[model samples]
Target: MVKNAYVHIPFCKSKCKYCSFVSYPQLELTKQYLEALQEEIKYFYKNEPLKTLYIGGGTPSVLEVSELADIIENFRFDKAAEITVELNPETLTKDYFKGLKSIGVNRISLGCQTFDDEILKSIGRRHNSEQVKNSVELAFSAGFENINLDFIYGLPSQTIEGFAEDLKTAAYLDVKHISLYGLKIEDGCFFYKNPPEKLPDSDTQADMYLKAIEILTGKGFEHYEVSNFAKPGFESRHNLNYWDNNSYYGFGIAAHGYVDGVRYSNYQDFDTYFKFPHVHFLTHRVTLKEQLEEEIFLGFRECKGINVQKINEKFSIDFEKKYSQILAKYTASNHIQKTPQGYKLSDEGILVSNVILADFL
Candidate 1:
């Protein structure tokens, strides 16, 4: 049964230089896009109660409070479902946050990529550090108690000391969730052609990560996932669906979904997607072998790693018989370990997780 849903709104006030996500600056499409989105959800939503709902992308809060309310009212959500909306700091208004809360949104994810003013300008984000502080206060003023603040590290000219200060300030911000992402020079992004200078070297970036981890965990945040930290019970339920390998419905250009062991994505090009305004999507199915491989990869991203028994039960495979050879190799190397009830990565395994995960794939 489908339990999670993601809606991508491909409109942003201004696109970031480092982002390669499917988003545009054409704000005029707001009305028609919302209508088209509503039609698509009406067609494929199954009207089933949902466990989680996430409104992401270009910048979900770019819409007016009324528009966001209209978009949310169209869905059939489960009681006490974890409903979330990603907000850019500049677009966060008190009325907007309250409107979202009134429509059952319980979580707000603010894309505060960094707290440094110079870095914010360099990244082309119009919002500054004070804007983030004010926006978060607006959310709390709207009675939003569950808030997530996202940040990035390893930026051009970033120092471990600077990021440490950010961490300390963030811990003092009274937020319950934090997501830390490393900057990557992605294709199609401006950074790919004009890469930033003085980006932390690989070794320095690793040290920055270690330092941030030390600070955050000390402030009582649990490092639940590789790049995410949360106070008790504040983990992102929408993302947990992916790590748990559960089914979710994704809508909008470039959005991807996994249903019934099949994975599919809507066309990436907005112009191409606009042609099929009302269609939920065209999709391709993933194989059982693919599922097993993905489970190993995404599962071990969590600190707990994989649950061998659970994998066996879901995919109907004997954990040992299926990969006795693979297991022997990694187990001997101490990359994987066997527990009383399951298998998981050792501490060293998590560090080189991609290497081990790629082998399984």
Candidate 2:
């Protein structure tokens, strides 16, 4: 049974450049979208005991506080559920957050792309450095103890010193969580045509990433995942569910779901996503081979590598039997260790993880 769920609110005040996630400008469709979302929960979940509830979005805070509460109230969550909502810092207000607290949203993942005003507007973020600061203060004042601030490194025109400054400022805050992201430019956004000048070199980006991992780790924060850091006991439970290959119900346009060994998503277009009167979900069961592929891919995303013993035990197949040649290649090269507990990537292997995951595939 799926015990965790992710609800994607595909509504943004305006789209950000370099973003390809399925969300649209929600200027007038907020009410209708919430209704559709409620119908979605009612139709699919039938009210299970959700251990973790994540309300991610183009911008979830776009909804009125009351609308946000009504959306959150649709679920029956666990007593100590880790309920998180993604908020654009610009949309937050003091009153908006108090209602959010009352409605059981205990975690706020604020998108504070960069503390520098220059970088903020360049990336099309609505909030400036001060607004970002104020929104975090607003949430903290309203009794939100768990907050995750997101910032991107390796932006088109960002410098290493600028990136470090942003991290230092956030660290100075009493915030318990940080999510660092690397910028990826794609088609259909401002970056596609007018990609910024003097983008950070791959080597520089790697250096920046390593610097962040080192700095955050030394600051009493655990580098639990490639892009996430947390103080002790504050690591994200909802994301851990994904890395562990546990099942979850994914709702909204372009949101992905895994249930009963199946993986699928609804159509990406908003018109199609909202055309249905009631909740609509589509399922595509994974072939056993596909499931195994995903297990390897997702597990390696964490600092803790995959457990070979568990895979062999659960799948009832020898790792050597399935991929003897691949295992021989990496093991001989010292890219992996066939440990008693499991197979783990070597230090060199962690940096080239994409290449490692592709080896099994």
Candidate 3:
């Protein structure tokens, strides 16, 4: 069953320097874009009540609550479905928060990349540190208990101490969840064209990540996923669905979806998407070999790790025979800890997870 869905709103108030997502600052295109999105949803949605729904952005909060409601009304959610929306601090208001609850949005993922005023401007984020604090307070006032704050480490001019301070501040706020990311200069982002000076080196970034794990775990948050920390029962169900390789529907321009072992993406261009929003521009049928690789890579991302027995039985292959050499190397290095269930990345392993995960592929 396709019990998870992702709705992409490809409009932002302004583009952030590090963002390469398909988003535009033109408000005039919103109406037409939304109409096309509705058409796509109607044509593609399988009508199963969703167990989790995530409305991600450009900036979903840039739209008025009424407009957001129009989008939400199209879906049939399970009785206890988790519905989340990505919010920008400067875009929220008390009324908007209340309206969000009315439309069944129970989770708010605020993009508060960092708590430094100068860094905020440097990254092209419209909100300042004060706005971020105020936004969280306002969300709480509006009865939002399941709130998530996003933080980025290794940013230009960011030090290990500075990133640690950000983690402490997020913990003090008492949010239910947090997501920490390392800055990458992806092609087409501003940093890719004109790289930022004083960005932390890989070793420094590793230290920053370790510090975050220490701080957040001390604050009673569980490191549920590689980049996500959450209080008990507050883990992101929609995201877990992805890690579990469950099928889902993705609607809107540049959105990607995986359903029944085939991955597909919508056209990125506005004109192309608007012309035939129901048609996917890219589609790839995942092979059994690729599926095994994904199952390992994605499952290993969780703190609990992958179930070796389950993987072996599901894929009809002996896990040990297939990857004994890979296992021996990492296990000998203490990068992977063998658990009763399976293998999970050790603290040392997580610091250089990309290198290890790439080797698995």
Task: State the lDDT at 19 in candidate 2.
Answer: 87
List all candidate RMSDs to the true structure: 1.9, 2.0, 1.0
* Model 2 steric clash pairs: none
Candidate with more favorable, higher TM-score: 2 or 3: 3
Q: Write the per-residue lDDT of candidate 1 for residues 1-361, one digit (tens) a residue.
A: 8989999999888878888888989998787778767777777778778889899998988877787777777777778899999999985778778888888889999998889999888888879999899988999899999999999998887889999988888789889999988888799888888888888887787777778778999999998888889999999999988898889988777788876767777876656666775553567787877778888788877766778888889889887887888889999999888877667777566667778877776
Q: How far in Å is the alpha carbon of 63 misplaced in model 3?
A: 0.8
**Who is ahead in TM-score, 1 or 3?**
3
Error of 2 at 113 (Å): 1.5
lDDT of 2 by residue, 184-267 (tens): 887878788887887898778777787887778778888877688998989999999999888998877777888777786766
- Where model 1 places Cα greater than 4 Å from the true spot, the runs are 280-282, 324-340, 346-348
lDDT of each: 0.83, 0.81, 0.91
Among residues 3 or more apart in sequence or in different chains, the pairs in candidate 1 whose N, CA or C atoms overlap within 3 Å are none
Reference-based TM-score of each model:
0.94, 0.93, 0.98
Q: What lDDT is reached at residue 120 by model 1? A: 87
Per-residue lDDT of 306 in model 3: 89
Give residue 267's error in model 1 in angstroms.
2.2
Worst 10 residues of 3 by lDDT: 351-360
